[model samples]
Target: MTREVRLTPVNEQNLEPLLSVAVAEAEPDEVMPPVDAPAGWSQARRDAFREFHRSHFGGLAGPTGNLMYAIEQDGDVVGMIRLGRTDEPGTLETGMWLGKSTRGQGIGLIALRLVLAEAIAAGARRVVADTRPENLPAVNLLRRSGAVLAQDGTTVRAEIRLGVSEDVDLLDAG
Candidate 1:
């Protein structure tokens, strides 16, 4: 039961399908910033989702720009994965979300490894991820992917050193 999951670069052609999948399969809070809409996937929330992905390249809240990828499972957009730079040199930040229907599967781990490979190929020495303590699945995925976890209040920060040979090996294992 191979999932045939791959990260596709988000572009103009795929934006509509990405938005559609998100609106139908995921809640706004689970995938994007809290949009003040009148419940359900309203037009305003849909528009915001488009703009969020569109404006991210140069408008992110980081020193460096962001790279966004559509998480495609068997050619359908199920979620998104993002990599961005931090103020610290040789380091990058990561974030992702999967549709509710896709949760509890190994898709996230595969996505993490793919994104980490992208980070390594881009010469990033480390990658960091932040999630809430309640996101046990993400915490476990980060740990299994070789990230060291540190909890600050409700936020759990996972940091992975990509420069280590053993860490790279972990990526290849399973």
Candidate 2:
């Protein structure tokens, strides 16, 4: 049976699960290519990553344009999604990660749909995401979601314009 998962806005009380997912997905030892590390990162990058996580979580409690949300399945937190630069009028960037046990079960696609719907509901005309070229799953999801690849460099940038007749059948494909 397909499980019903819901995405809800992140808040102070829900920060732990968000951080847990970030820590769980951290690739500390993974060698990122120069393009992936456009900012010229090093071992010190870990601290920067930590700070990013901290600020993201902290943003949930503060007034910020970044919108964070948690994915819940069967009343359990399975993943998290974020929409940055949401205060702008036209478009926003999206990010997401599922818990280890929850991956590959088609939840990611559903979660993405939910977030996309949320973005549209929030008056966003478009949604964007950047993922490493090696991240086939994410790339495929974005492709399958009808997000056009605007930039195919080290980190691919994909985007979708909302309220279009062109649609993505993520749940059916899964």
Candidate 3:
């Protein structure tokens, strides 16, 4: 049986578990990649990383356009997916990471399908995601989800058109 993984807005109580997942998902060499750094980031880059974690996972309780959702399985948080920068209205970028304990369980594919469905239902015409060139698992996952390779450079951009309803079923078929 498949459990429905819903995207719920994050708040104080859930911050710790979210941070724990983030830390657990990252290896020493993969904490934050250079691509994650914004332009002109100096020491502030590290500070910004800390601030991002604090703001997003510190449980301060504030208004944020960024919608963070926890992936729940068997009533436990196993991973997270974020749908961000939706100001464009019809297009959204997604980022996701799953806990090590939950890896290789085919949960990421299910979570991706759920997020794509939610994005389309929320009026997103296209959804995009980027991953490092060396992240083979993510690359394969995106391709398996029917995301076309748009740009393949230092970072790879994968996009799926949500304007057509068939794309949703294609992603969910597996």
TM-score of each predicted structure versus truth: 0.87, 0.70, 0.70
How many pairs of residues collide in each model?
A: 0, 0, 0
For model 3, residues 111-135, the per-residue Cα lDDT tens digits are 8888888777665678889988887
Highest TM-score: which candidate?
1
> What is the C-alpha lDDT profile of model 2 across 1-174, one tens digit per residue?
869899877665665665555445534332121233434334355455445544555442245556667888877777677876644346778888777777788888888998888767655678889989888888898998999986566889998888833353221221
Residue 21 local lDDT, model 2: 53
Local lDDT at 60 for model 2: 25
Order the candidate numbers by TM-score, best to worst.
1, 3, 2
lDDT string for model 1 (105-164, tens) is 899999999999898876678899999999899999999999999999999999999864
Better of 1 and 2 by lDDT: 1
Name the best candidate (by lDDT): 1
Lowest summed lDDT window (length 10), candidate 3: 57-66
Question: Candidate 2 lDDT (Cα, whole model)?
Answer: 0.68
- Supply the global lDDT for candidate 3: 0.66
Candidate 3 TM-score to native: 0.70
